[model samples]
Target: MSRLYLGIDGGQSSTKALIAKESGRIIGHGRAGPCNHVRTCQGRAKFFEAVSGSVNAACNQAGIDASTVTFAAVCLGFSGGPEDKEAHSRELIRSTKYKITHDAEIALSGATAGQPGIITIAGTGSMVFGRNAAKKTARAGGWGYVFGDEGGAFDLTRRALRAALQFEEGWGRPTVLRAVLLESTGARDANDLLHRFYTP
Candidate 1:
């Protein structure tokens, strides 16, 4: 039997899995929905779905039975911090070794090819991470959608909505953003759009 390895990138938008051989030849790839939340029952369900869906898909593509195969190593990089997710992952994957970490670390490793440098990721959220020659590392600004995540997609959308609300309420200068947002979202006004955002 050949030794197999697995790598998964679990992000806010989606999750991807790759299965490779000991020789670094990629044998399979799969993709599924997001798995960034695990604080609630519904969130944990979604997390399980995303991780299992992607891993099973990859195993199938590689012509391997996931239940019977123990990977030599597995690495999963998640969009949110990995503190709450390690145990959940352990229950699902059988691996000799595991490297569970935040998405930014993997992104920096890939971007710099394991060199000492910095990388900024701006997707659903925003964060910056770096490593120095001394092997020290530092990170900033991955506080998520509620508190931080400045310059992220959610932040930009919030700013646009706030502007539209101000315009509709006659408290701020008029701009075409109000009309554009309303047309794009099919909202009668900024207030309606805001309500829709809160509705699931």
Candidate 2:
């Protein structure tokens, strides 16, 4: 029997799974929702659901049932680095030959093809990580949703919103972003943003 392998990349925003043969040829791929453990049971359940759903989807894409596909090895590169959670991993897969690590580890490996190089990831969050020729590694950013991720989309959006509000209140210079944001959100005026943004 030609064995199959599974590789998962789970992150705060989404999860991806790939199935390949022993020869390293990718046969199937799938995607699922965010797997980040956010709150108690719900968090864990979401993570597990993403993992299982991704794996099964990949299997289905390859025209096989997940139960019939025996994996020789399973590797999970997940977000949140070393604190991704081992218990959830155990519940996600039943493979003995399995390993789990931070999502950035795989990102770096793929970006450099196991060679030495630097990689800066900018998405929902932003991070800079690198590996030297001698195998030394270092990282900057990934400092949670608040203090870090300086150049991420979420941060930029919030800043734009703030800028718009400030401009409307005559505290900042006028800019087109204010109009664009208001038009997009359908806010009647700048004062309405305050209530909408903080209504919760």
The alpha-carbon lDDT assigned to residue 88 of candidate 1 equals 95
TM for every model, in the order presented, reads: 0.94, 0.87
Candidate 1 residue pairs in clash (backbone atoms < 3 Å): none
TM-score of 1: 0.94
Top candidate (lDDT): 1
Which segments of candidate 1 are over 4 A away from where they belong?
none
Report the C-alpha displacement of residue 34, candidate 1, in angstroms: 1.0
Error of 2 at 175 (Å): 2.0
lDDT (tens digit, per residue) of candidate 2 on 21-102: 8898998998999877445348778888898889988988987788755688988887666464666666666665877777
Candidate 1 per-residue C-alpha lDDT over 1-200 given as tens digits, one digit per residue, 9 for 90 to 100:
78999999988888999999999999989889987778854888888899999999999999999888899999999987786888999889999999999998988888888899999988888999999988799999998898888998889988888887788888978878889988998998667888889997
lDDT of 1 at 179: 90
RMSD of 2: 2.5
After superposition of all CA atoms, the RMSD between model 1 and the true structure is 1.4
